[model samples]
Target: MQHLLLVAATILTSDPVPEDEDVVAGWPGFVIFIGLILAVAVLGYFLTKQLKRTEANRKAGVFGPVDDEEPRDPEEPRS
Candidate 1:
């Protein structure tokens, strides 16, 4: 068993370890394409929802700024 283990270790140590650059170069385009698809999807979703809300608000009449009571005197220093 010890001899077998020694032979395996020697084989493994003699082989060159794989490098990151080779792995990264193989998949760079796939990563960038996925990122672009994700970004377009998110932006489209938000813009669609915003447009829908604006249309609904326009129909509801209570769309603009609020007009409640009077403004307090700013002269009083806040604690």
Candidate 2:
């Protein structure tokens, strides 16, 4: 219909201006962003430390026998 076409054309041509032109992420947003970055950094540091300790423990055979040794049978008595 002609009325529908006219309405569509008007809608397409119209550019609605915003009430506040200077919209921005303020100080609170900046602070939260900084906090997230710091949290990730701290978590990464702790994770690295724990991973190093675990690697050291593994090399020292804390978990069990070394990889080169054959696994012992459960039914066999220890010497």
lDDT of each: 0.80, 0.87
Candidate 1: tens digits of C-alpha lDDT, residues 1-79: 9999999999999999788775554467889889999999999999999999987786666666432355656896544
Worst 10 residues of 1 by lDDT: 64-73
Misplaced by over 4 Å in model 2 are 1-20, 68-79
Instruction: State each model's C-alpha RMSD to the native.
Output: 7.1, 8.1
For candidate 1, the TM-score is 0.45
Q: Which stretches of candidate 1 lie over 4 Å from their true place?
A: 1-25, 63-79
Q: Report the number of the highest-lDDT candidate.
A: 2
Error of 2 at 35 (Å): 0.5
Q: Which lDDT tens digits does candidate 2 get at residues 1-79? A: 9999999999988967656856778999999999999999999999999999998898799977565568788899866
Give the 10-residue window scoring lowest on summed lDDT in candidate 2: 15-24
